[model samples]
Target: MRTTTIPVAAAAAILALTLAGCSGGGDDTTGGAGARTPAPPTSAPVTSAAPTPSASSTGGRASAHTEAELTGVFQRIQFRPAEFTTTDAMLDSVYPGLTVSDASCLAPFGVGWDTSDDAGTVVFGTSNDRSMTAVVASTGETAAATDLVEDARSALTRCADGSALFSMQGKPIETTVETAEPSLTGTDEAIGWRVRGTVGGNAFTLVGHTARVGGDVVALVGWDPTSNTTNVPLATQMFVDAL
Candidate 1:
C-alpha cells in the first residue's frame, strides 16, 4: 500500500462527521438493538438534504455571535486566530456527501465556519501531526439543540464497539470506535468519543465532543498521531460559555 499522510484537520473533519452518524459502513448495533447487517463498501459519498426551515426561520429570531466576538471567545480558550475560515459553500464543495441529520446539532450541520451565516469555525496549532478545530452555531432551537446532544450520547454509546470502514482520498481505511466520558459541566448537554486506527501504516487517534449551549451547539475535534487523549471538554466549555 502506498503511504499516505492524513492531515490532522482532515482526520478531525472525518471523525466529527462519523461520530454524528454521518459516515457509512459497518454493522449498526447502536441503541442496543440487534445488529443491522453491514452494508457493502460504497463508493458513493454520503449526502443529505438541507434542513427543513423551522418556525424560527419565519417567526422567531435566529441569532449568532459576530465573527469577531466568536474569534475573541476562541482566543480565550487558547486557539490562535483562524488561519482560514470556511463557509457553507466551501464545505459543500470539499465534503459533498457529508451531512448531519439533526439540524439541531448546528455545529456539525454546517461543518466548518460558515461565513454566510452566524456560525464560524477555527483551527488551531501549527504542527502537521496534530490539530484542533472548534465549531459554534445557533439554530434558535434550544430544546431541540439540547435533545440533539442527548441523541449524540446515544449514538456514541451504540457505536462504541463499531468500526468505521470508508475511503479517504480514494484509499480505504478502518477506524475502531470507543466511548469516553464527556467532561463538559454546567451545560445543557454534552457527550464525547474517541477513534483509533491506522491510515497508510500511520496510526492516529481522534477525540471529539459535541455540546449544546442555550440555543446554540458547539463541537470540538482534536487529532494526534502520537497521543490518544485530548482536552475536548475545555475547548467545548469555552465556546459554550461564550455563547
Candidate 2:
C-alpha cells in the first residue's frame, strides 16, 4: 500500500457538491456486446492555438464537437440529456497542473453529469448513487492521443506508490491511486485507475477511465463517497461507440 497527499479543498469542492439526478426518466439505449464502432474525426481541420490558463474558457484550439455533440457522447453512455453540464471551473480546479498546449497536441474540455438525486443543479434522468464527469479532447498529431493516455497511466502509477500528496486549503490530505488492466476491448488504447483518500476526515473513492479513439481522447471520472467500484468499462465502451 502506498500513500499520497492531495489538496482536498479545491478537489473536494467539486466532489462535495452532490447534485441530484432528474426523475421519472428511463434508461438510455446501451451498446451491444459486439465490436465497437469508433467515433469519426472532427469535420474541420485542427488549428494551432496557444494554451491559456483560464478557468472559464478552453484556451486551446476549439474542438469540432459542439456542445450538443459532446453531450451526445455522454448520452450514449446511458446518461440522460439533462444530467450533462459544463464543468470548466471544475476542470480548472482539479487539473490545474495538466498542461493543455497546442504543441503538446492536447486540448482538454470537460462536462459533469449527475447520477443520483434531481433537485440540485441540472437535472437529468433518475436518482442513483453513481455520478460521472468526463474530459474529452482532440489530439492533432498521430498517436498523440495514445501518448496522453500513457502520461496519465504513468501519473497514476506514481500516485499509487503512496508518495504523492496535495494540499487542500491548509490541511494535509493523504491520497492513494490504484490501477487495473481493463477487461474491455476494441479501442485504440485505454486505461483504468482508482483513487482513494481522506480529505478533512471524509473518505472518497474516484474511479477513472481514459481511452483514445481516432484523434480524440476521452477521460471519464466517476465518484461515489461510499463506494470504490464504478461501471467505467461499460461507460468507456459506450463513449467509444458514440464516437
Q: Against the hidden true structure, what lDDT does model 1 obtain?
A: 0.45
User: What overall lDDT goes with each candidate model?
Assistant: 0.45, 0.42
Which window of 10 residues has the lowest lDDT sum in candidate 1?
Answer: 121-130
State the lDDT of candidate 1 residue by residue for 223-243, as single tens digits: 643332433544454455556
Model 2, 160-223: lDDT tens per residue? 5331245444444566766766654445677767777776686767777777655456676666
The per-prediction tally of clashing pairs is 2, 22
RMSD of every candidate to native, in Å, equals 15.3, 15.9
